[model samples]
Target chain A: MRRDFLLSFAGHVLVVGIAALVGMSRAVRDTRRPIVFSVSVVSGGGTPLPQAGAQGTTLVESKPKSQAKAQSTAQSKTPAKGGGGSGSGTFKRQGLGVGVEGAEALGYSYYLNAMLTRVSDNWLNPYAGQAKVLTATVVFDIERDGTVKDVKVEKKSGDAAYDASCERALLVTDKLPPLPPEFPGPRLKLHLEFEQKP
Target chain B: MVPTTGASPGFLGPFIHAGPFALVDVIALVLMSVASWAIVLRKFRTLGRASRQTRQFLSTWGLRTRLGDYEQVAQRLRHSPLSSLLLAGVKEFNALRAEFGNSQAGPELLQHMIPNITEAMERAASREVAKIEGSLAFLSITTMVAPFMGLLGTVQGVLVTFMTLRGTQIPTLQTIAPGISDALITAVMGLVVAIPAALFYNYFVGKAHELEGDMERFESELTGIMRREIVSSQVEQRKGQ
Candidate 1:
């Protein structure tokens, strides 16, 4: 019995040793997901005029310096008459953007842009690399108290997984800062097009 | 994307979040694994010795004409159940010889000695078999219990996971992944502990039975030899008278 006890103890030690070795050898390397969310603003009106001047305000990657300079210069030449907001109208290359429906014209694009950053920060892609390209458009309304309502998918990326992820991103960001007190409207409508390219 | 954080990371990462009940389950399974392995190793060594010694004892017995010639040999083959049976038979035969001397010996002597000797061998056989089969019950119990214990841990973990989902946030993979990990690790550990125990238990049981059979066959063979020797000696004594 004593010998068996010794042998069992040795066996357990060996097993634990091997397990520790394997675990130690395993590289807990950083896993960088390549899915970047870029939003295209479809202003409240029917036209899909991307805010030409508001290009550089994305989440991660910034647009090239030359292009940003050119857009800033171009904006100065022809300031978007009443296209709204008082921030850089320059576009960023591959980063997060906001699609403020008609808020830009009302000069609330800056507020909506900040809100978009918060939502994107909370966004976690469930279908990170499942497809080459995925795009899901979601529409929702923010009450005067900043609570989101009537979140629905406006366009499906043909993949339920991607659609669900986009919806979840919005649902997870259930509340946002209250609409700017200066804004006239009781609520703000948003049309966010979430796209992932390779 | 954001580098995933907040959850403890590693292969045993889920164990960090294990609740009180889950912790108990893990510790119990580990202990079971250790005890089962100890039993397995000890049984292997014992069964091997028994087999090797029994083979040697049988070979030695085959060469000897009389059971008395094997007394010293049986003394040395302690692990062999056959040796114990032989000793029991030889001891009974000696006792019967002292009771009935050559003048009293007859066909009735064979009848009386054979039954007593067989009974003694049977008693020794049962004792040896019991020794060989000892501690096997623990293996059987471990095989049966470890998996269910793991399952219990898993069910409890998932229950807690769902219960926590009642909070402000809707259930997402992030919110649910840790609890699910805790549940799955227990199940995986359960199978790990059970599979080997089950395999070794079956193997040891079979070995014990084989040893038991060996003792039974040796008993009958030894009894036959002892009977033949007695009959021949009695015939010679009667002829001289």
Candidate 2:
């Protein structure tokens, strides 16, 4: 009986030690704040500005007054400079834009809009009050469950903070709305740009 | 559970900040879990050996006609409860025959002999059952008490959290999160300890009950065989006279 007790005590200690090791080995998870957005009601509040990194004729597009109105009115917005265009024309041009592939045919424009708002909410510009305009382009893959992966910088905006803020925004927005069920694909690859202007 | 002050809170923050009461609860649960697991292992080996030896004894005893034919098999199956039970009955039968003289036993004396032998086997069966069931009570007690011990820690931790908040102008998520997480750890630990103990306790109890039933059946069969052996020997002696 004493021998059995000793054996069991040793076995229990080993099991607990193994479990604790496994638990400690796992990476700690990151938690984030919820997203929030504000809407403006008045018109003539501003004139259009040149889209950042615009190489050719700078189309001075009017700022769409609201997110819902912007999507409906500007469905034909052309993809500008390597798959980088805003899903909605919001005025607060806060260093965040998304360009989705095959979004219109899949009727998943709302998914893009959600991605923009969520990423923009987390996207913080280090040079928020500076007059220097900067734009950094990043590309990444979005799995079906909305997990971001394989994030890489395609274009650097010449400023380290500006580029890092864009990367951090995407990394921190770890989850977005899941892809539309009608869209049949293993994952969606996305190209995005973060533009900071005075 | 004071708020962690560093730029990056360490992963072991909750455990490190656990109160005195919570630490005690954790220690108690850990000991209970270890003890319960020990009983599970020991009972497993004991019951398994008992079952295997009983099977061997029964198979060998089945081939033998005379009561004396069992002595060799019984010696080899010392761990078998059935063997011990049979030995008890046979020993009583031999003593009775010695007292009455093998050739002179009447039907009236035979009646008393059967009951005495049955009584002896009954005593041996109970002893074997007690040995099999030993230490199982500790498992039962652990299952019932570990959960409540965890709950006590949780309640104490929460109470401490609220008390800390009494002086604050406002309680924000950052202010209360650490304390609440510390409190919840004990509850999780409690369930971890109790679940396996409960499962193993039920299992060992069932095995012990099964062995007891087997012994009871063997006792009745052995009694019937001993009675017939006594009666047949008396008949042969009368014919010889």
Candidate 3:
């Protein structure tokens, strides 16, 4: 009886230890990876977009000729056209551009862009060399104030760690540029694509 | 007894997929099931013997008018709870009557003996009931707590599952189903342990009540007999005077 008791006790201990180990390993694996949220900004003047994909940089030049043309368009479009011209043309019509401009004014695009930069810098893509290209689409809402809100991954990079890192980075940077006056916002949709170099 | 066999290959592969929580739940449930069966078998045997012995002793005691015959019957069925109660009442009555010496002294003499005998019988009955209820408390606790314990394990399993899901692109059944299955096993185990324990607890309680009622009825009958014997002795003493 004593021997039987000892054997059963040992068996139970072994079972419990193994179970604990399995559970711990699963938990550890889940927590170790990060999510990346990428934001891409495109301007209306037909400049070539950045090559770095979700994490690239673009410079916007405010040239005199472009500003003059934008002012003339605003003046021509206005019905009540005297003192309200400057405020309406520059702040409302010019500020509201399509794509990233609409996204930025709602405060979503800027926040998302900042987030993507941080996530990419943190880790190198392990599959960069082996895989030809990795692409992910991010969906987000732009509020009227030009802030990005409710950013989510519409598609994934397939790697569990990479996917999570993308999401986490998006969540951290939730700010974007003000919407141009042309678009009214409760929510607006913008699609961002991220590509890794082969 | 059914011989233990190796787990079937088809089921074993799936069972291996179940995590540690699921495995523990399965083992605990199996052990509890076996224990419940053992307890049920043992209880049936004990209660059956007690009922048979009590019936036999009562029949034999009723046939003989002499107290000595009843005493002998009580000795033969000492293991029986009913017999134990009867023996206790009879011994108390005999002791009290001997102390008073000659029932011709008065009705007061028999009155004290009746209460003392009743008290002794009741005490003995309670002790016997408690003994019959042995290990039943543990069974009751097992029934109540096993499910909750399983629930704790399941909750932990679910949390791990969700956390893992958050890191993945698309949450699929392959990754999430095992944790859900693991959690459910605990609840099943709890119900398994509790159901039989509750049924047996009620059964044992009913048996105990029946035995107690028998003891009470037997005590009343013994008191009536003592009253008649005392009255007859007193009437004979008056005639002699």
User: Is candidate 1 or 3 superior in DockQ?
Assistant: 1
The CA lDDT of each predicted structure is 0.67, 0.66, 0.53
Can you give the lDDT of residue A57 in candidate 1?
A: 30
> Which candidate do you rate higher for lDDT, 1 or 3?
1
The lDDT of model 3 is 0.53
Best candidate, DockQ-wise?
1
Tell me the tens digit of each residue's lDDT in model 1 across A1-198: 778888888888888778767766774442322111224421121212233213223322212323333443233221222232333332332211221212122255555566665555455555443445766778787765778888899889898986887787689888988877655444555656666543
What TM-score number comes out for model 3?
0.49
Model 2 TM-score, all chains together? 0.63
> In terms of TM-score, how similar is model 1 to the real structure?
0.65
| Candidate 2: tens digits of C-alpha lDDT, residues A56-148 | 111211122243235543444443222123222433222112211121222444565556556665666666546667767677777667888
CA lDDT of A106 in candidate 3? 31
lDDT of 1 by residue, B8-43 (tens): 265556676688888889999988898988888888
TM-score of each: 0.65, 0.63, 0.49
